[model samples]
Target: MLRATSLSIVLLALCACGSRAPAPQAAGVAAPDARGPTANAGNHAFQAAITADDFAAHVQALASDGFAGRGPGGIGEDRTIEYIKAQFARIGLQPGNGGDWFQTVPMVETTADESAVLGLKVGQTVQQLTFGDDMVVGTRTGQARVSLQDSPLVFVGYGVDAPERDWNDYAGIDVRGKTVVMLVNDPGFHSGDARLFDGERMTWYGRWAYKFEEAARKGAAAALIIHDTAGASYGWDVVRNSWSGPQYDLPAKDDPAPRLPVQGWISGEAADALFKAAGQDLAKLRAAAGRRGFRAVPLEASASLQLASRSVEKHSRNVLGLLPGSDAPDEAIVYMAHWDHLGTHEGGTGDAVYNGAVDNATGVAGILEIAEALRAAPKPPKRSVLFLAVTLEESGLLGSKYYVAHPVIPLAQTVAVINLDAMAPVGKAHDITVVGKGSSQLEDLLKVAADRQKRRLVEESHPAAGYYFRSDHFNFAKAGVPALYIGSGSDLVEGGIAAGEAASRDYNEHRYHKPGDQYDPTTWKLEGIVQDLEAVRSIGETLASSGQWPNWREGSPFRAARDAMRAASVGSR
Candidate 1:
């Protein structure tokens, strides 16, 4: 049976809706036996191999001030990578790719100077918008200076160019050397159902990164996204912090997205104001962005931003370990977690380390634990098992993006990817939430393990978050590999769904991506962490042993990609 501790989550969620502070957490007395279920036989062995106390200790060590928040290119990376390398060593797994465990990912770190202005012109008015308040801009451009003053601006609905859905926002508009402004979330977000773009499932089209790339491919000088709390999954402050930090991008060899001269976000308030200035109603424009053949509307406004940035090119490693399979070591099952976090911004708020305890320290720890468990098992997996601790996941999933572009093992032989990002804290829940549930058959295996634990398969409670595209697994998914990204369920101990939701809501506001996310023994529980980690690990191990390479669920967008890969594999061989 399944059992979880169900600890309270300290998520510092900043309700992106600009709503008031979340309703108060109702004080409820403790319930008997917070654990939900007990592991039986095989699961019991797996559970014993991983425990809550152990998880806490590892997370505490990683999230502690010592790691300095584990940001990339910082001193924290030194300690974090060593720790991961040591963990793989302790687990007794062989170096995954070639001889060395380190897959050197070349990265360029860029930090934009704050005092710059986007010399924007709308008709007779030449307004210079400030960096943090009105806008947040940065570039992947290798150039020293990028100027986009007279570059025409166009509103390209969701900025999606999907032919299958018969929707192209860029139709009849040549965005070359222009700036394309688009909405944040998918069309279904505002229109609900009966509209295109995955209804409300948040296809890749809605992602801000996709907007920039699509605009860039269309030869746009810049791309801007109108940020709303609900659509972006966080507040403008979140946007500011995420944008302001030192950004890492995979080197050009990593197929670096064609850098737009300026890629930035405008606050919802600023966007509304800009809308008014351009004679386009924000509400009406949002509605228009959802329909088919949405045309790009010229804002008749021009944005010119000069970003002065300090560029540093450094190399970070994606730690990889291999367990060669029995029959076909050529084929493999992959398990992954990102090793990077916001890191120490240094003197900022006296928090030098972004220990990323919950943000992902738990996931890295989970990978280490899984590695140990698999190493101890008497029978090796039938296909190889690749354990990867990727770098720069916090920075637009650059590490995984690099790996897929230049795979140590062929992407064709790579059967599936299991990703751990921000696992459930030390609490026991009655269910698990698989983020992109319908994408692959891995969820079925997860279901088997969850059933063994007596837990239910919970549908994602917040699909609008676009969490599927937010993590490292998306990089693999985009390259035709089926991926599993499971998140902790929102079912609490004494509170059921309400209690769990309260903790989740709290953490998102107060702790998410902040220094306040340090490990706490008193307020947190690692029971759930161990439980879910065990669940994901069990699935990976099972897949590695099974001859079947798993399948995407019917009607899954990833299914076509998977099927195409299968055909290509057969034809090539």
Candidate 2:
């Protein structure tokens, strides 16, 4: 259950690459590359052909200068689109986008001026938090001016409203016309008990985005999350840089909910200061927020913010390719990976490009490799396979949202989605993390494959980060398609814990969404990546072969949708 830093994980990779391989293998056995299959004593020749070198070439090309860091809607996306389309073509994957390889995702890019000021009021202290340094705020509302005044802030612990679980943070209070400041994750996180809210595996309700939405649903004018290193999973620098750039999001015309007038995060220190000013102890308030009938506490701090906004209509593309099944071409299996990063951060590093070598180039390459393997398989699958390289994932899961809305195949027939994001190119680890573990039956299929590889299955270390909802896969999950967005674990097979933890920590500080995240052949090992990819491919194979369609667990929100679809299909038959 212990979690390692990103750097430690990377170091684990480095040490593993330097070390020797496990157990003897016969000659000509292929080692796992970035593709899904691993090398052992008797790997098929087809498996060996798609070796580590194949993985390396794809990643290097995707991260290279020609792609310009693959920023969505930029020249970068153009190059990325062409490159992926070509790879799908080479693998004999026909276009999935209604005979087209590209799916248009229209986005509204907004830039709030750096000069924007958030005037904060606590007691008599009037603190002005600058936009980029102290905090960053953006409004998805298509408006020229954004404003919130005399909005009383409330600490609504987690801002979760689940009637099914008998938990409501706003049980006794009316948050309408007020601002609700909340914690980042679910309560079970601090409790560590599996009885509450899927324990460490984040539910959609635990996501900060959901918190903001719930606040808006409760008629609150604004929402803010208290930032903690453990809770949010990223540092303030990540927040600053990620939000500071041009923000990409789908047009709001499709959404029916009212937008939060002001949404942002308050640093831990700043949040503590505010709690003290309101004569309420921060720890006590946090504790109370986790209770079953927690009431929103009035911090009585009003806020006034003025941001200069600029907007543009930008279009990104989702590369879609299909491998029709031998028996059931209409039913599809989707493999999705985000193909965009922060692009070139001006003047941030000596090298401007945030190449995102491991953040997602590795993920995109995995898809290409898997597509080739599926193409080379002895017989086509009964269900078709969809290889998707979506855009604006770093910004949001926008490209995927667009695809689901305009899917070439009906959403009901889409069997499953296996999302590979930020695959670790480090050494082989002892575990593979299934992030949204209990959402569907996919976890069992993965466990079977991982066990065969002598690897353990681990839950996500930072579930409060809402990693399930954070990536492109969330779009599919929300659309009633069973989804999997697993991660490469930080437990090293050879070098052990210290080395694994170090690699993860280093990545957060040095490479994550930064210029230094370029292709690092000297440091990375594709062994772990191959293990994860194969696990995904195995799951896809499982779904393709099984006549029975898997559904979400009994209590899942998606269960009703799946049932309804199944009933209609039965009626038609």
What is the C-alpha lDDT profile of model 1 across 40-146, one tens digit per residue? 00122223277776566667667765566666665566667777776676567888779897888898777778788876678888777788888888878756666
Candidate 2 residues 107-180, lDDT tens each?
A: 88776677888777887787777776676777777576888776777888888989888888888899888878
Superposed on all Cα atoms, the candidates' RMSDs to the truth, in angstroms, are: 7.9, 8.4
lDDT of 2: 0.72
Full-model lDDT for every candidate? 0.73, 0.72
lDDT of prediction 1: 0.73
What ranges in model 2 sit over 4 Å off?
4-49, 191-196, 199-201, 347-349, 555-557
TM-score per model over all chains: 0.89, 0.88
Best TM-score among the predictions, by candidate number: 1
State each candidate's clash count: 36, 27
Candidate 1 stretches greater than 4 Å from native:
1-48, 567-573
